[model samples]
Target chain A: MISLAGRDILHAWGKFVFTGVGLGLLIGVTLTMAGVYRGMVDDAKALLDNSGADLWVVQKDTLGPYAESSSIYDDVYRGILGMPGVERAANVTYLTMQVRRGESDVRAMVVGVVPGGPGEPGQPGYLVAGRRITRGHYEAVADIATGFQLGEQIQIRRNLYTVVGLTRRMVSSSGDPMVFIPLKDAQEAQFLKDNDAIVQQRRRTAENPAFNRPGVPGLLNAAIASQSANPYVNAVLVQIEPGYSPDDVAEPIRRWKRLQVYTREQMEKILVGKLIATSARQIGMFLVILAIVSAAIVAFIIYTLTLGKVREIAVLKLIGTRNRTIAFMILQQAVGLGVIGFVVGKISATFWAPIFPKYVLLEPGDAARGFVAVVVICVLASVLAIRAALKVDPAEAIGG
Target chain B: MLTKGIRINGLKKRYGKGETAVDALKGVDMQVAPGEVVGLIGPSGSGKSTLLKCLGAVIEPTAGQMTLGDEVIYDDGWKISDLRALRRDKIGFVFQAPYLIPFLDVTDNIALLPMLAGHPNNESRQRALELLKALDVAHRARAMPSHLSGGEQQRVAIARALINRPPVILADEPTAPLDSERALAVIRILNQMARQYETAVIVVTHDEKIVPTFRRIYHIRDGRTNEEAGEGRAFE
Candidate 1:
């Protein structure tokens, strides 16, 4: 027998196509939402990967230098370097701030890395363009996402640094691009007072009778010098030797060094499980709402389409058409509409993902699952229309 | 009782109970032999629709005996298990509006009956094509129902009814929507199709133009039927 549903769709293809297009846009937004969540997770992972460290040593009783604020002495990595299985250890600081270039400000994670060549922990892994920072002060390596070009000067706090290199995918867990500068400069930018404050502090010390009894002349200057310097770093990035497991290197740092040490897996848990957990839930709520709206739209559309064919259904019933046959026809039409919508949605997501400010990763697995979900949703949504169609009395066709 | 065509004996259909009891068909009795065309005429609410519904198996009679050909289909209770299948195979129906499946072309609309009865697609189409040819609508076989004129759609409906070669056909005001000329033409086609397929046809109509074409007519009033001879005018 000819396909009753196919013929009906062809008969009114303009309406079907228009409805499909409308549904497709909704599906596109849903896919994009999912991609945004995926991008967050990916950024978190990229932050960890670009660090080139198997273990992270932060202040005790803290979650991270990423998820939360953490501070360790700038010299703490010296002890970690002597530990067993320790290959290299470097201090790093992370501060999310708006760095200025020309007139516009780019929100980025300001990273302070210890002076090191390529392949060092806490340094950008590779550069996409230009060269990595060779000098310790007023030189910066910025992620391409920061919209910073090489040889351009950007202001971070009171210091102006030239962007010497551009890296790709180096971002904080929050998806802010990372701007790398020397560890000493970042420490001063993070904690050191301004020139006015330092001068005022020195004058205040000179007027103090406790230090100027005419007996401790050098003592006041020595105290002032200590206050002028910043000796704290956010965290110590530890690189383990080839033969050492992350857990092995991290345990000793936590035990003897008396600091919170997180392995790669533990850090990932902190980033994904704690840092962005609420955002993921928010997106999940959006997904649920979108699904409900999608199902409602499908149900309403299918119901209206079936209503238009009430006479046809009545005639089919009067002519001894089985209830299942009529139900199947409506069901097939709904699924066909979903299939078309899914194709359009996939294309729309792919076309628009790159334009988003944050990285948007649309995985194939998500697309496949979305397709199945669309089909299942369409099938379920068609139930209302099917019930309405089946309730149509065959006697209606023979009108009084 | 002769074992052929359609027979109805003492058929009754009453709605509600006690004070609200309204009898639509009270002891309706009628019979039509194979290849015979009978007309059922009645005034509004005179139980013509009730009797037609009972004969079409759309509504069950309160107490009655209904036979199609050699089968006893209804005797107070349904003898056949699936009334839908019985309707598809043993009875054909042509409504006033033709009621063709609008999405289907003329050929599939007519072929659907035989296809539903388990005939192969090609064979059903072949049978439908032959019937369309007989009804003089063969040229419009592939045309959609919407594309066909009223006369063409009516002819396709006649072809659909005769495709199964059923022994009985129930036509409810088959020519009510047509003008006099088209009305007479539809009745003439029904007559020719009935004789050609050796099927009995019962046409319930109010069209006076086509009423006299039947050899025998049944007049119903106040839930009762009386058989009478028609003028049986020759067709043009």
Candidate 2:
């Protein structure tokens, strides 16, 4: 038999198309929400991947430099390097702060890395432009997401550094673009106080007379000099040799060095499972609410559409149209609306993801799952309309 | 002898139970020979609608005997297994308004009954086309009900009723929405179609415009009917 639903839709195509477009926009928002959550997880994973480390050694009993605050003596990597099966070890510091360029500031993760060529642990592995930070103090490699251009000067704490190179997809677990500077500069930016605070500290020490009684002038100055410097790093990034497992290298650091060491798997758990777990749950709750709203809208639309055709339905019933045929008509229309909405939503998400300030990763697998969910939702949503249609009195066609 | 028409005897329908029981149809007896057109006229609150429902098999009667041709359709209880199929195969109906399926084109609207009865697509459509031609609505066969004029939609509705070649047709105020000229024209067409198809037709209406055209009529009031002969005035 001819498709009654198709014919009806064609008969009132203007209404159907307009309604479908409206529903499509809602679906688009739903899809975009899913993309945002996926982007957060991707940013966390990319942070780990770009670090190029097999293990992370941080302060004792701390989660990580990413998920939590960690502090370790900068020289601890020297002890880690002498261990067997250790390929390379480097000290890295992470400080998330506002970095200024000219008049404006951008929130970025400032990474302090030991001077090494590309492929070294704690260094940006690749560049989209310029070169790596070859200098010890003034040169920087900024992630492209920071909107930084080569040869541009940016302020990190009290010192100004020039952006020497650019990288892509290097972000913190919080989705801030990474700016790689030399270890010394990053440590100073992280721990150094202003000139006023330093002067105030010196005066406070000289006036105390604990070390200076006009007899120990040099002793107080020497004590103040040591306090002015920062010799601590946030974490040690370790690269294991081909035959050595990350657990093997990390176990000794945890045992002998008295520091916290995490394998790649453990760090990932910290970043994804703990660092951004609450955000993921929040997005999940939004998805559930959107799904319920979508289902309810579809049910209401289908039910109204069915009610509008009560007379025709009665006529069909009087003419011996089977209950299934009538039910199928309503079902097909609901699915048709969902399909229209899905296409609109997918297109909208793709077009707008880039405009979002944070990275928005839209995975193919997520889209596929989304499509199936929409179809299932449409099928379930059509139930209310189907029941109402089935209950229509065929005798209405005969009249009183 | 039993003919290829509709017959009814001692039909009764009661609503509710015990102290609140009300008999909508006390005892209804009616018949229409094949190729005959008859009128069923009644005032408001009468049992006309209830009897029509019973005759259309939309509702079961408390006690009744009804036959189409030689087949017993209802006797105390339903003799037919599927009343829906029985209605589709053996009965046709034309409402006060066209009540055409709004989603369907004129041709499909008429063809729907035959299609529902398991006839092949081409054959059912051909049957519908022939009826449209007979009803002088062949030119608008492809038009949607919304696109058609009021009179044209009524013609399509009539074609839909006759598409199954049913032995009995129940027309509930088929001309109630028409002007005097159109009302007489519709009655004339109904009479002509009945004689051509050898089908029995019963028109229920309170319209006075076409009342005189019927040679036989059944007037119903307060759950009862009284038979009467009309003037049988010819349509101008």
Q: Candidates' lDDT values, in order?
A: 0.89, 0.89
Displacement of the residue A38 alpha carbon in candidate 1, Å: 1.1
**Which residue segments of model 2 deviate by more than 4 Å?**
A213-217
Sliding window of 10 residues with minimal summed lDDT for model 2 chain A: A208-217
Candidate 1, residue A317: lDDT: 80
lDDT of 2 by residue, B154-225 (tens): 888888889888898899999988998888888888888998998899999999888899988998877777
Per-residue error at B109 for model 1, in Å? 1.5
Per-prediction CA RMSD (Å) = 1.8, 1.7
Candidate 1, B80-191: lDDT as tens digits: 8887877777778889998888888999999887776677999999989998889888999899999998989889988888888889988999998899888888988988
Per-residue accuracy of model 1 over A1-400 as CA lDDT, tens digit each: 6678898888788888889989999999999999999999999999999999889999999997888889889898999999999999999999889999988899999999976788899999888998887888999999998889999999998889999999988999989999999988999889767789878998998788776568666888787788778899989998899988988888888899899999999999999999999999999999999999999999999999999899888878877778888999999999989988898899999999999989899999989989999999999999999999999987777756
lDDT of 2 at A186: 92
Candidate 1: the clashing residue pairs are none
